[model samples]
Target: MIKHIVFWRLNDTAYGNNKQTNADILKEKILAMQPKIDGLIKIEAGFDFSGEKDSCDVVLYSEFTNKDALHRYQIHPDHLEIKKWLAEVR
Candidate 1:
């Protein structure tokens, strides 16, 4: 299996939404991919509650059956849309 992890430290405000709200939206969009995309073994997203100064606002963990599956997931249209939104939000 292949493990893919991503961390994001969002700006205080972007695209008119606060960091927390944007994180929430991002989490929802990411989680929605599991059912649509094939070969995704597992996926999760969460906010940092560690109380660390350098903590990221959001983290995404994903497991894929293989590198090819991971590559396919990366280019998935839904994911692309989320990526665009995240880029603007951050």
Candidate 2:
């Protein structure tokens, strides 16, 4: 299996939302992708509550069946969609 993880530190304000709100939105959006993607064994995300300057606002973790599965996920339309949004906000 392949395990993938990501951490994001969002801008104070992005997409007309504050960092905390965006972090919650980002977690929900990422976690919602699990059932839609093939070969995705597991997926999860969480928002940071510590409010530390050095901490990332959100974290995403996913598991895939194989390397190919991971690669496919990286390019999958659903994944690509969120990636695009992250680029603008993170």
Candidate 3:
């Protein structure tokens, strides 16, 4: 199995949305991809609540059958859209 992880620290105001708001949207969009992407064993995304100064605002954890599966997920349309939004927010 392959594990794919991503972390994002969003600006206080980005893409016309606050950090928490963008985190919520990101969680919704990322979690909704499980059914659409093949070889996706599991996936989860959420805002961090550690209250640590160095913690990221949002994190994505995913498991795939293999590298090829991970590659497929990377290029999937839904994921591509999310990537674009993330870039804008960054």
Candidate 4:
């Protein structure tokens, strides 16, 4: 299995919502991928509860069957769409 993890320190406000709300939105989007993509064995997103100034706002953890699966997920159109929105918010 291959694991991919990502952390994001979102803007204080984006998409007309606060950081925590945006985290919720991101988590929903990321988790929604489980049934939509192939070779994605497992996936989850997390919120930062540390309440520390330096902590990230959200996190994504994913598992793939192998390198090919990971690569496909990286280039998949659905993920690309999310990546675009993510760039703007982050």
Candidate 5:
């Protein structure tokens, strides 16, 4: 199995949305991709409540059957959409 993890810190204000709000929306969009990608064993994302200065606003944890699955996921259209939106926010 292969695991893919990501951490994101949103801008205080971007695309007219607050950091927390954008985190929530982005979380939902990322979690929604689990069913659409092949070989994606599992995927989840959420906001951080730690409040630590070093803590990021959002986190993504995903598991795939193998390295190839992980590669496929990177270019998957659904994921690309989220990546594009995140670029605007970050």
Candidate 6:
């Protein structure tokens, strides 16, 4: 399996939502994707509670059967939607 990991840092207020709120919403969105996607061995998403300025607001950890599955997941329409929203927020 291949491991895919990502870290995100949101602006203090993005798309009219506060950082924590936006992170929470995004976390839920990401976690919800596991069941819909194919070839995913495992997936996890969460926010940092470390109270450190250098910490990323959110982190995603995923395992895929192969690189192709990872690639497919990256370009999947639903994934793209979230990625676009995240781009706007970041």
How well is each residue in 14-64 modelled by candidate 2, as lDDT tens digits?
899998888888878888888887899999998888888899888898999
Ten-residue stretch with the least lDDT total in model 5:
23-32
Query: Which is the winner by lDDT between candidate 4 and candidate 5?
Result: 5
TM-score-wise, the better of 1 and 6 is 1
Which model, 3 or 4, shows the larger TM-score?
4
For candidate 3, write residues 1-90 as lDDT tens digits: 999999999888887888889889999999999999889999999788997999998989999999999999999999999999888776
lDDT of 6 by residue, 1-77 (tens): 99999998888898888998998889888888898889988889888999798999889999999999998899888
Q: Which ten residues in a row have the lowest lDDT in candidate 6?
A: 28-37
Best TM-score among the predictions, by candidate number: 4
Candidate 4, RMSD to the unseen true structure: 0.8
Candidate 3's displacement at residue 11, Å, is 1.1
Instruction: Report each candidate's C-alpha RMSD, comma-separated, in the order given.
Output: 1.0, 1.0, 1.0, 0.8, 0.9, 1.0
Residue-wise C-alpha lDDT for candidate 4, range 4-35, written one tens digit per residue:
99989899888899888888888888988898
Question: CA shift at 61, candidate 6, in angstroms?
Answer: 0.4
Better of 2 and 3 by lDDT: 3
What's the TM for model 3? 0.93
Q: What's model 1's overall lDDT?
A: 0.91
The number of clashing residue pairs in model 2 is 0
User: In model 3, where is the ten-residue run with the lowest total lDDT?
Assistant: 10-19
What's the lDDT for all of these models?
0.91, 0.88, 0.91, 0.90, 0.91, 0.89
> Which residue segments of model 1 deviate by more than 4 Å?
none
Q: Which RMSD does model 1 reach against the true structure?
A: 1.0
Runs in model 2 deviating more than 4 A are none
Query: Which structure is stronger by TM-score: 2 or 5?
Result: 5
